[model samples]
Target: MRERAVSGHPDRPGRTPGVTLPSVTERKGTTNESGVRAERQGTAGRLPALAHESPATAFGDYRAAFHSARLPMALLDGDGLIIAANPAFGELLGTDPGRLTSAAAADLADLGSDPRLWTAYREVLCGRSDRLRCTRRLKHPAGQTLWVEVGVEPLPGGERFLLTVADSSDRHDLLARVRHLQMHDPVTRLPNRALFFERLSSALEAASFEPSGTGRIGLCYLDLDGFKAVNDTLGHRVGDRLLSAVAQRLSRCAERTGGRGGDASRGHLVARLGGDEFALLVENSAGTDQVAELAQCALDALQQPFDLAGQRLSVSASIGVVERTAAGTTATGLMQAADTTLYWAKEDGKARWTLFDPERNAHRMTRQALSSTLRPAVDRGEFTLEYQPLVGLGNGRAEGVEALVRWRHPQFGTLAPNRFIALAEENGSIVELGRWVLEAACRQARAWQLERPAARPLFVSVNVAVRQVWDSDLVADVAGILAATELPPELLQLELTESAVMGSAGRPLQALQALSDMGVRIAIDDFGTGYSNLAYLSRLPVSVLKLDGTFVSGFRSQEHPNPADETIVEALVSLAHRLGLTVTAECVESAEQAARLRRIGCDTGQGWLYARPLPPERITALLDADGRTDDF
Candidate 1:
């Protein structure tokens, strides 16, 4: 079989016409030296018999093959005008084959001046590259959008170029749909976490390479307040509807604030991270001021009531806004900071936005780390005990010591009880921690007893939390610890907060009475801080009342004396003594306050005036020195 001879159209005089070749292999990956030759042969063909036959007959055969070929093919002149086109190319442009001839190849669709297309066209026209293949969006005259893969190759015998287009509408559409599903939330229809991270990373990358003004970025991470309660009561259907509504409002807000075209960083992109959490990424942001305005807008939009499931429900959100230059920031760092700030908003009382503060976040992170490490710290014996002397007001002698628990944290050094006690309680680890303190205190007290057998037995008081009283076998634990340490019950006092004792009713009340009857003295710690039930106090077997530090603080300015505080303290002491309960004034920071407490008939005084908290060896030394001083 002779190879098909390609010829140019006679009407378009100096142009080379293209031959129709057989179907060839689809080009995948990239084009190389051999691939370019194959592309020209596959789409245009050889013009071998052009020099052998007459122009008219050769042109006739070329025209016959051009018209007969199944693919959409157009033959362009040196000036990029389509001198001739196969019927398939004409059909693709929604025109007749005769009408398409001599029209500018670009004028067939809206892409005549597209830079990307023209750039490749220039490269082929100027002999810089062999062939150009690109995917373009073309609008057909038949009122349908078409995605076409175009191939531009230099004609073999003239200054003309060959342009072949293959319909890629189905493949492009399928790919686009897959991308949309992956990047979007099905219910809310907002960008999901994956796309948000992608865009954020892209923006950060661009900012890193750009100049100063374009380098700043911002993010606002938000969570709906009380969404769990709504979901639990109304069902998931209503919750989903509520989420959709929120998404719509957020989208509108982003659209209103978003910048157009290439000013992408000045634009807002809202996304749903999952569940009730949502985030907004702001590119090329004007610092936190811009982000703050966006957060306020989001809050206002969510403030409106949602009509879901025939009920009018209103919800508020907590937002954490972060803004910084992209030079040293990362997607993970920004998100973690946003998460931490958002939690601060929830903790500081929700329904508002909070800005990121490094100091506060560090403190919170430390607390969180401590909370997570509490049980393990206990297991590792990282906690130790310190004793504060409880001196008798009459004799100025250290009668007993209150055992305070401290964490010998490897990183933070020794931490006081105030730093981590509430954290322990909140995480339900206080019961175990309290038991450890009790056993340790008992063992220490027995050590002191054996060290000093002649002097009066100095009692040790251990504070117990309300959780420990109710959650554990308090009486049994105390019994076992005492039996193990060989510490007498009378020599170990259990200090319960005023709220703990006053709030005790059924089982807690029983537990307190059982321990009190077992010869464990019960003292009300921080007496006036809570609701002090005077009448209820008589019903319990209470041995002592620890006056709150507030009244002791008043005694510090006794020169310009607060007569009312004096009257209150005096009255409290008189009333407690009448009920057969000893009164111990706490936080006695001055000799004057100590003298005032003694004058007011208070039994014991505990504070910095006597001594700050000390280790066991220091307490023993203080006791020995006091004994030697009494001899003097």
Candidate 2:
């Protein structure tokens, strides 16, 4: 086939027969011949007329341009069959121009491999679309992969299409190199955070859409334990070398676990997510066990010492493993869970692996929620006191009652002191909560005293946190509460844990002595459990010793009574008597335990044996029933 050329008709002045070429007067909408002449004169330099040339001469010039032009060009018939090809087009595919005739244009560059592009190519040939343009990867006969931009446009008469190809291999290679640098860590030479999250998101998306997938994803997030110490002692140069070595080992571990069935394509992705932190992502994880195995392998690998520049240093890592279904999962959520589990590993003493536990996480979240709401709860009056009776061992009369605080949390229901006391102390909110307890207990004790003006009044003992003394004016708080309630100072006993009062030489000791001098009693709570310093007891003005529950729990069974526990209790009680301090046994669950405590000369007892901590109404009922009831 010969190259097609544009020709003019003999009847028309300067237009082709089948092709319509609008005259300048028509295009500019100028009816006057003078205006048309002026418009044509303005564009005369940019547009040159070829209508005067013969058809044979125009054909010759077209054939020369097609054969010698640098741009790759081809002519395709309406059926997509290559009718003619230029030398540049032949060189682009590394073939002879003569051998390309009658070949499908889509088959030459493998453009038909993609259904969309193939359909678009056929659309242009059939005149359904004006043009089709896309980039395609083609293999040359010389064993080279070439990236080319393929463009198809309809020719005159719309029966044939002109196909052009532009080599874009250099641009593609440059972009790929830039992407590699952007998505990798400089020091570790591993994938950086950007690539890690990208792959994670893609894997989740694939798992969601692909039915043949495992439907699960996994991650092992870890960091070097005690890594900062190395960076502090040694210089960062050594630190960096150590991190690189750790990254290499982690990469090997990931590869080993990922290639389980001899498939390298199924391998995991190891990435350096900044500093000593690293992550290994499993695209199609089997289950938690698979992820855990990967974590264990990483831990074992890092347990070995790294030799960096002649300095041998031992290091370890803590790993958090998470594996679950890809449904309803997101990259951010997975990363958050992995981070929390990693913290748990470090908290569990480091150098170990921890799996994500929903229960444990929920507990932590509950603690955080409770901590944040503590001070507000106090202001909202969520806390109330429950009284546990302290009975005299000699007459079995209710001598006093220990005030245990309970939180009537609206959302969590009733919470005991064990749940939120430590949180309050840590946040320095215990001072306020402790003050509330003191005033409330004193007021309630005053109420009880008014109820029974004739009976011996029950003293109310309130537990004092160490921070309450350090963070607040305990002496003034107590004195004000006692004066306001008109309850005698002696009737309000303050209890401090043994640890808090053991080395009490500073403000704590001063506060205790000042409270003691004001005629208020001081009791050492949980005496036997902490710092059992019997000699140190003489220095403080503590008047009561509350033995811990462990000592009383041993005296439960009469036949198989713990002789050692009994001897210890008796010795301590005797010692307390000598020191002018009364002994109160705690956690007396049964009558047998209570009887044994009484026999041991325990001055007072507080436990379930007498009564569990009860509401004020129930205690009033007990007081109304009898002056001093044994049990409710």
lDDT (10s digit) by residue, model 2, range 377-460: 999999999999998878877888889999999999999999999999999999999999999999999999898887778888
Evaluate all candidate structures by whole-model CA lDDT and list the values in order: 0.80, 0.81
The per-residue C-alpha lDDT of model 2 at residue 357 equals 97
Candidate 2 overall lDDT versus native: 0.81
Judging by lDDT against the true structure, name the best candidate: 2
Query: On a 0 to 1 TM-score scale, where does candidate 2 land against the true structure?
Result: 0.83
Instruction: Predict model 1's lDDT versus the native.
Output: 0.80
Backbone clash pairs for candidate 1 read 265-283, 265-284
Error of 1 at 401 (Å): 0.5
Could you tell me how far off, in angstroms, the CA of residue 567 lies in candidate 1 after the best superposition?
2.3
Candidate 1: 10-residue stretch with minimal lDDT: 1-10
Which parts of model 2 have CA positions greater than 4 angstroms off? 1-87, 96-135, 150-164, 260-266
